[model samples]
Target: MPANEKLKEKISHLPHKPGIYKFFDDNGIIYVGKAVDIRKRVSSYFNRSAQHNKKTLKLVSQIKDIEFTIVDTEADAFLLENNLIKQYQPKYNILLKDGKTYPYICIVNERFPRVISTRNKKNDGSRYFGPYPSGTTMHVVLDLIRTLYPLRTCTYNLTPENIAAGKFKVCLEYHIGNCKGPCEALVDEAEYNANIAQIKNILSGNLSVAKAYFKEHMAAAAADYQYELAHKFKQKLDMLEDFQAKSTVVSNTLTNIDVFTITSNEQCAFINYLKVMNGSIILTQSLELEKKLDEDDTDILASVIVQLRQEFESTSREVITNIELRLPLDNVTITYPQIGDKKKLLSLSLKNALYLRKEREGRQEKNKEMSEQRELRVLETLKKDLRLTELPRQIECFDNSNFQGDNPVASMVCFKNGKPSKKDYRHYNIKTVVGPNDFESMYEIVTRRYRRLLDENQPLPQLIIIDGGKGQLGMAVKALRDLNIYGKIAVVGIAKRLEEIFYPGDSLPLYIDKKSESLKLIQRLRNEAHRFAITFHRSKRDAGTLKTELTDIKGIGLSTADALLQKFRSVKKLKDLTLDELAAEIGKAKASILYAHLHPAEGENA
Candidate 1:
C-alpha cells in the first residue's frame, strides 16, 4: 500500500495538466484532490524531504490505486474536483458541503428574453438551455447566439403598447447594431419573435431547424424579387455556416445523444457519461459506483444513464454505447454505433473507462496458481461474487458464431473450478434461428442444451456465462424462464466492452476489478466458448467447401447428391467415372448429363 518502486513507475505516465486525481484503498473511494500540475502535486506526496504532516502521511499509506481526469483548464479542474469531492465525500478532503453548484444557461422571461448564464433556475416562464460542462462553454454559446441575433439584451419590457407610444429610448446596444431598437418600434414584435424562435431551436439542439428556416426565408425572398431581403437572409445563412464550421464536427446529422462507458474492479465501477448536442459535447463527467454483485458493463452503463440523466436534468432520448443496452427507460433509443460522431463519442467513453481501469489494475499482477487451495478460493469468490447458493465449480459459457449469416453455430465451453473442462464442451448447429441473429441463436442453443441435459438427467452448470451483453443474455434468461428454471443457477453476461459484468433484472453492470479471479475465470470461459464456436464454424465451412463437388453440379439435389457421393466421394473419383459406370447407378440420361457437366472439354470434343 506504500508508494514504492511500482507506484513511482506508474506516476511517470501522469501528465503535467490541471485535473482531478483520486487515491483509493482496496474497497472504495478514500481521497480526491485537484491540482494545477497533477504530476508535480502527486509526486510531492512521496517526496522524502517533504514536511511531515500526520494526516497527509496517513492518507498516503492507504493509497492502493490512483486515477484522474484531465481537463482543459485549472478552473474546470477546480469545479470538477469540487463536484466530485462533494459527490464522493472523500476522507482526505474538506468537509464543507454548502458551496456546491454548477452553471446553467438561463433565457430570461421578458418581451425580448435576455439570454444569460446563471447557476439558479427560476420559475418565471423563462426557458433554460443547459447545465453546460463548464463556464467557458456557456460563454462561447452565449457569444454565438448574440452574434447571430439582434435581440435586445436590456432590462426594458418592450410591450406592443409601450413601443407604439415610443415610451422607451434607444440604448448603446441599438447604436452599436447589436440590437434593432425594439424599444422604439424600429423592429416589430413579429420580427423579434422570429429571431427568438430561431434561438430556441438552436438552444434545443435543433440547428437543422434553424438552418432550414434561414434557407427558406432566403428562397422566398429571392422568389419575390426582393434582392435586398434575400441578401440579408443569405448573410445570416453564411454566418450560421461559418459558426458551424468551427464546431468539433458539424457535418453529421447526429444530435441530442448521450454516450456512456463503464469500467470496474471487484469492489467498484467507474462510469463516464457524455452529452452530445448537434455533434458537440456539452457535458461530460465520470462517476463511481460500489458493486453489490457480479454486475456487468451493460448494467453499470444502464444504471449510470438513469442516474446521470436525473442528475443533469437531461432529456436526450438517444444514447450511444459500445454495446446495445436494454434499459427500463421509456422512449430512449440505445444504439451501438459502428461509425460516425456517435462512434467517436462511444470510443471517448470507452477510453475514459479503460484509463480508470488501468489506474486501478496497474498496482497488482495476477498470481497464476493451480493448487487445491486456489481452486477453492476461486469457487468461494465465485459464489460470493455472484451471490449464488451453490459454488460455480461447474460453469458453462455460451457464445454464438456466424459470418455474414452463413453456417450459424453456437458453442458452449464448460469450466470446473476456474479451469476448462473440455470433455463436456458442446457445439450446436443453429436450427431455430435463421440467418445471423445472435440473440435468437443463443436462445436456440440454450433451449436445446438445457432441454437435452434435463432429458438425459445430466448435471447442469452452477453458472451460465452469456458471452455478450444484455441482449443475448436476455435470450438465455428467457430460455431458463421457459424451462421453469429461472433462478436455480447463477447467470451473468460478460461484455467485451469495458469487461462489464451484468446481472439480470439490474440496471447497472457489476464492474469487477480487472485483477479479480472471478472476472479472470469469466474471461477464460468466454474466450474458450468463443474459440470453440469459431473453430466449429470454421470446420463446418471447410467441410462444406471440401464436399462442394455434388453441390456445385447442375440439377443435383440433396437426394441425388447423396447418390453421387455414395458412388464417388471425391471430385477426382467422379471425374474418372466412365459413362457406362455412371449409367449403372443413375439413368442413362442422368449419367450423360452428369458426364457433360463434370467433363466439359471431353463433352465438347465428343
Candidate 2:
C-alpha cells in the first residue's frame, strides 16, 4: 500500500474522543498533538479542501502511520501529550526548556519536623511549598515563621528512641531562643507538632488560622494575669498583620484564581503565571518556550496553562488569561476580563511577561556589545606589541603534525579580530616533502597558501605565525621571497620551550610580559594551531587503521567505521562495547553485523 493511503486509513479509523495523537515515519515519532476530537483533528491533515501552511503540509506528507490514546477529557489529553513530548522529544513539538530550579520551603519528614529552604524537590514524604520567585520574599517568610514558632534548626535525628536514650545535647540555638531544646527533650513532642501545624498554615497562605491561634493564646494569658506573656502575644499578632499588609492584595472578594499572560516574538513565547490566594498574589512564575511551528499566542497560552498549573499543583476553580482560550475543562471558568480588577490582574501578568522579554533581549544586547569592545581592545594591544603599521585584524597560524614521520599533515588556523574564525581554518596533506622535513613542509604549505590567495584575488592576512623557532620562520620568509611578497606581510615564529618570539632575519628572540594580554593571544593561536594539526593527523591515522581492521567486517563501510572511531577512538574501545551500545550509535542491523564479526564466540552462542 502507498504511505499516504496507510496514513489516511489509520486516521479514518480514529475514534471521535479527546486524546493525544502521534505521527510517525519508519524512523520514529515525528509529531505529537492533543485535540478534543481525535478523528476530526487527524483527518484535517488529509483534507485537501482546507488551507494548510507549508510546514503543516510537510508534516502531513512525511507521516506514514498514526497512533492515539483515548482520554476522558481535554485536560487529560493535555497532560498525556505534555508527558509524551517530554519523553520522546519529537522533532515537531514546542520545546519547553525549563529554567533554573527555584527555592521551595520544605517541612522535613521526621519525628520533629524542621522547616527550611531547599532547591531540590524529592519524593520522600516531606511537604514542599512556595517555589518562590523572589529569594528575598522567601527569606522574609522564613523569618516570620522563625519568630512565630521556635522550631529546631539542627539536623539531629531527633528520633523518639534517641531522645529517650539521651543521645543528644542542647546546642547554642536553644540558648539563643531560636529552638525549644527538642533534642534534649525539654519541649514535648505534642506541643512542638502543634507549632508545626500553625507554621504549615502560614506557609500555605492561610495566615488567618495562625493569627487566630495566636489571638486565643493571648486571651488565655490575659485571663491568667500574665501581662508580659500577653504583651508578647500582642506583638506576634501585630507582626502577622504587618506581614499581611506588605503582601500585594488584589481584592478581598477575589480568591483562588490563576492569571496567565503570554508575550511572544518570532522565535519564542514567554508566559507568566501568577497564583492568587485569598486576594493576594502568592506565587509568580515565568516560562520560556521555543516555537517549532507557526502556532499563535492563544494556542501556546492554552498549552502553557495546563503545563504550569500541573507543575505548581494549582487547584483554582477559575483561570484568567489575556487571550480567549476555549479549553474543555470541567466546572472551570475561563475568563477574559475587560473592565474590572480581573482585567488589572491580567494586565499585571502581561506586564511581567513583557518585562521578562525586554530584560532577556537587553541582556543579550549588552553582552554582545561588551564582547565586541573587548575584542577591539585586545586587537589594539596586539598591534602595539608587534609594532605593526596596520592592526592585525586577520592573523593566521600554521603548525605541522607527524607521528614518527608518518601521516604527515599541516593545519592553518585563522583568528579574526582576536577571536578564532573557524570557518577560515584549513588542513593539508604533505604533497612535496618526503618524511619528517618540518622546514620544507612549512615552505611548501606557505607558498601554496599564498599562491592560491593571489590567484583567487583574496585578501592577505596582516600577520603570520609559524609554530617553531628560527628555522621554520626562515622557511616561511623564503616562501614569501620566492613569491616576491616578502616585504608585504609580517611573519613571526614562537619557540615552545620558553615561549620566545622570533622575527624574520632576527638573531635574538623577544619576550613579552608573562601576564600580558598580547602574550596570551599569541599563546592561544599557537595552541589552537597545534591542536588542529594533531586532530587532523590522528583522523588520518585512524582511517588507515580502520581500513585494515574494521573494513574486514562485512557490511561496515568507511563512513561507519570513521564514525565509530570518532566516538570510541579505537578498535580496542569499540571491541569492548556491547551490541546494544553499538546499536544506539549506528542502527541495529549494522551493529549486529559488526558485533558478530568482532565477537564471533558470543555471536555463535546467540
After TM-score superposition, what is the CA distance of residue 538 in candidate 1 from its true location, in Å? 75
Which portions of model 2 show Cα errors greater than 4 Å?
Answer: 1-77, 80-131, 134-136, 145-201, 208-237, 262-271, 286-307, 322-336, 482-484, 549-606
In candidate 1, residue 223 scores what lDDT?
Answer: 100
lDDT of 2 at 93: 84
Candidate with maximal lDDT = 2
Which regions of candidate 1 fall more than 4 Å away from where they truly are?
A: 1-100, 164-166, 217-232, 245-256, 264-270, 277-283, 286-303, 323-326, 333-345, 352-606
lDDT of each: 0.78, 0.88
- Please give the RMSD of candidate 2 to the true structure: 7.8
Task: Report the poorest 10 consecutive residues by lDDT, candidate 1.
Answer: 361-370
- Using all chains and alpha carbons, the TM-scores for the candidates as numbered come to 0.40, 0.68
Worst 10 residues of 2 by lDDT: 1-10
What tens digits encode model 1's per-residue C-alpha lDDT throughout 1-606? Answer: 123555787788898998989988868788777677899988888784357356667778878778989998765675576578668877665433345466777778888677788988778788887777568877877887888788787787777888888788999998998999978878877878888888988777667777898899899999999999999888888877776665555336766788887767776777777777777665677665665434566655654566567657878888777776666455778788788766777887889877877765554344333366798898898788777898888999999998889899989998887777788899999998777899998889999999999899988888898999999899999999998888887889999989998899887988877888877888888888999999999977755553576667676656776776654556676677678777766768877878888899987797
